[model samples]
Target chain A: MRFFRQVWVVAAKDLRAEFRTKEAINASFAFALVILLMFSFAFDLPVETTREISGGLLWIVFAFAGTLVLNRSFARELPNDCLDALIAAPISGAALFLGKALANYVLVLAVELVSLPVFSIFNNVSVTAQFWELMLVLALGTWGLTVIGTIFSALTVNIRLREVMLPMLTYPILVPALMGAMQLTSALVAGKPIGADNEAWLKMLIGFDVVYTAVSLVLVETVLVG
Target chain B: MINKILYVLGIAALAILVWNIYTIARLPEETRQGEVFKIIFFHVPMAITAMICAAVSLVASVLFLLTRNFKFDALAVAVTEVGLAFLAGNLITGSIWGREIWGIWWAWDARLTSALVCWLLYAGYLMLRRAIEEPTQRATFAAVFSIFAFIDVPIVIFSIKWWRTQHPQPVFWAGGSFPPDWTTHFLWNMLAMALLGAVMMSVRLRQEEAQRELDSLRRMAHAL
Candidate 1:
């Protein structure tokens, strides 16, 4: 009961803050849309090439947009002694992590909801089938991202070149998620069944999310106290 | 006693490295790669040294997290710094080698790309430590990242193997048997380079500990 209250407090705080400013969501949405547009023009290739590369382009946009949002999410918290206040509160580290990750996951999902159809329009790819699989992959992948990103944001909040450092630190570790997402997206886009290959990627995604979340949960107390 | 022993070992290692370089220089021109093959000695050692340093950093970071001791954190940072230096050497030497051999300065080859990514990740880990204001936070976060970054090392090592299943066998892992002559030199050089990496990491760790002590004293003076 107490833990839920603690989680709700942090979640409510983030929700109220984002509702007032809307800075993070707006930036992420515009940035991702711009990337999709850039890709549409930059390729200049035939539809076949575009179809093949569209999946990769979509993932890239999500990654870049995700990083921007994740960076700002904690950047806002850190500036006004908000993080210190939270630390002083009676919230458990696990609850804090859950709250931050939930907020990020929602923000990322909202960005994706707007970007997905826009991506299909730009690339002329159909998205009727495999919608749920795509959503599943995105949800799993974003959960993994939020888990790692929240931890790193706390880590890099005090760093000098955080914008550059966040992606640099995040992306390489993000390879497994990115690869899993890309593989699943590619398979779905190519009209393949969500069979063994898709299952393999799904397994990898689940494993990554489980392992990273566990590690973050266990280690987050150390990070917060420090 | 330790200093004298290290000095002797260092000199012996340098002599062996010099001799190996000379031998490579004097080797008859290969039909395939010609003079570019000469770069292999430097490139291979740099890669090996980088791997050694990253491995050490991973171990030290894990230890630091488990113990919550500053010494282990210092060691992790020291090894990561050394790892970055060797990775830079690898990239430079590998780029030069590529230009001569492949007629291009850079290709999106699996090995090269993965190595560059690994290097950038560790470099970012260091930057994160520098940016944070608090000591315990810096140590914990940096240690966490070091562990995560080390997970990519094996993937980077095997990337080429996975990508080139149809190509001729890689020299390092061919037919489940080691080529005796090449293995001798490779193992010897790798061992020496690993030792050198350790020596550099130890020196840097000592410096980091001293710096931490200085920081504490400065804080105490401010408090007073």
Candidate 2:
């Protein structure tokens, strides 16, 4: 009961701050849009190639922008000694981590929702028919990304060169999740039924999320306290 | 005393490695591969050495996480550094061989691609450690990531086999049988290479222990 209240407090605090500033969301959305435009110009305007590559391009854009958001989420907490107060509160470390992860998930999802339509428009691909499946993949992939990224961001927030090091350290470990997400997205864009490939990717995503979350939860206290 | 023993063993290992290189140089040039086949003696052993080092680091990481002992963390970092060195060797030698044999420096072949991924993953692990200021946090995070990243090793090992089954097989796996004459020498050199790798890791681990002791003394002096 107390843990839930603590989680709600932290989550509400983050969401309210994000709502007020809109700094992270705006920057991420803009960054992703620019990437889509760059992709349009770099690849010849052939519809087939555009459709085939858009899924991967979209994910890469989100990943790059999402790093900024995750970094800011923690950076915001650090200033004015907010993180010290949070640490002093009677919250389980796992609850604190989950709350931050949930907030980041919502922010990442908002960026993706806005970017998806723009991606379709620029790449000349139709996502209207596969909206629900694409949403599912995006949700799962973003959840995995946020869960892993939140923990790592917090772990590295205290370090020097953190802004640069966070992505370098996080991206390689996130490869399996990224690969799974890209495969699912590509299949949906190509109109393949979510069969074996989807199943394989979904399983890999779930496994990655569970393993990293469990390990991060166990180790977060160590990282935070030390 | 230990240094003297290590020096002797190190010299003996160097001698054996040189002899192995000489034997490979003397082998008749293959009709098809020409001189490029010589790379196998170096490239294959380097990969095997990296794998051995990675496996050792994996064990050390798990033990460190379980025990929360700092020594195991040192062991993990030490082995990973050695592994990265050998991985570098593998990549360079493989590239040279590829240039001579395939007429290109890189082909995005499954083995080569996976080797690159493995290299990047461990490099990230090392960078993560360096990024953190606190020793305990560094060790904890590094131990966790090392174990997680190691899941890619088996995937790399089997990728060529799986990709061959799905796509057209590469020349290396086409026959699916070891050339009989090459097998004995290859296995012998591989065994010696593995032993040399183990020896190198043991030496490095001892050096890490000394460094850690030195660090502790420095901290103590500062506290005073």
Candidate 3:
């Protein structure tokens, strides 16, 4: 009970701070829009080809632009020595990690939400045709990214060149999940029927999210307080 | 004493490797792919040795976290570095084999892609170590990250396999009537590569320990 509250408290703290400043939120959305625009320019493909490949493009944008939100999750805590203070507080490291990850999830999801409409508009695909299934994929995929990106954000928080280090460390480990997400997203965007293969990819995504989140929760104490 | 053991192991590995090379030279060309199939002798063993080194490094990383022993941390680094080299060797040999047999230097096969991803993951691990200054903190963070990385390995292999598999299935031992001596030769090659990996790890471990000592001495000098 208390643990849940603690997680919520930490999450709410980030939300409040981020809302007040709107720094990471605004920047990530802008970056996401820019990426979408560039994709249009980079490939003036036929509408059919765009629909076929837009899933890959959407997640590429999410993965690249999502880093903006994640990179700041822990880095923001550094300026005021807030991370150390958080560690010194009565909160468990797992709670702290979950809190930050939740906040990141919301922030990244917001960027994705906005980007989806723009992506559909630009690429002439109908996200509304498969909104619920698309949301499920986005939520699971983004959660996988947030869990990984958040832990790596903590891991690289104190390192020099952390912005670069965070993605390098995070991306390779993210390959499996990214592949699963990319395949599923591309299919859903193309209005294809979800088959056994898509089912497997979805399960893989769920397994990735659960396993990574559990491992991060268990190891967060050692990583943060050590 | 350790140096003497390593010396013997080094000599044995060299002798076995030389003998294996001679034996491979005399072996009949494959009935199908001709002499190119012989590369499997090196390719398979290097892949096996690299996997073993990665497993050992994973254990060392866990042990370091459990015991807070810097020696385990050094072992983790040493074995991973050596493993990365062997993995690179495996990839290069496999590429050469693929080009000869499949007419392409690369394929998005499950095995090849996962191996490449594994290489990148460990490379990132070493890079993470370089970016940290405090020894304990560095080890802790690396160990934590290594655990996650190792866990991700199976997911990577399975995901890629499920996503799409194009790599050829094992053909050497699939009831094909090959000379029985080839099995012995494979075992000998495996032994040689394992010993070579071990020796390389020991040498790197010593360097890591020496580097730690120098770091501490430098800090002491700064304080004085």
Q: How accurate is candidate 2 locally (lDDT)?
A: 0.80
List A-chain TM-scores for all predictions. Answer: 0.95, 0.96, 0.98
| Model 1: CA > 4 A from native | A1-13, A16-21, A41-45, A158-164, A193-204, B1-5, B24-42, B92-110, B160-178, B216-224
Model 2: per-residue lDDT, tens digit, B112-215? Answer: 76678899999999888877766777888788778767877886676665444222233334474436677556766776676677667779889878887898
DockQ of each: 0.47, 0.52, 0.81
Per-candidate TM equals: 0.85, 0.87, 0.96
Q: Choose the strongest candidate by TM-score.
A: 3
Better of 2 and 3 by lDDT: 3
Which pairs in model 2 have colliding backbones? none
Error of 3 at A84 (Å): 1.5
**Model 1 residue A220 CA deviation in Å:** 1.2
Q: Would you list the rank order by lDDT, best first?
A: 3, 2, 1
Candidate 3 C-alpha error for residue A217, in Å: 0.7
The window of 10 residues in a row where model 3 chain B has the poorest summed lDDT is B152-161
| Residue-level lDDT tens digits of model 3 in B64-135 | 988998999999999999999999999999899999989999997557877898999999999999899889
What's the TM for model 3? 0.96
lDDT of 1 by residue, A73-174 (tens): 678877779888887877788899888878888888889878989988887887656777778888888898888888877767766787878887888888
Residue by residue across B1-224, what tens digits does model 1's lDDT show?
76676677777777777777676577666567778765666777788889888898889888988888999999889989999998998899888877786677888655676788898889878777877777887888889888778867886777666454221234565463434565666666676676777677767877898999999999999999
| Each model's iRMS | 2.6, 2.3, 1.1
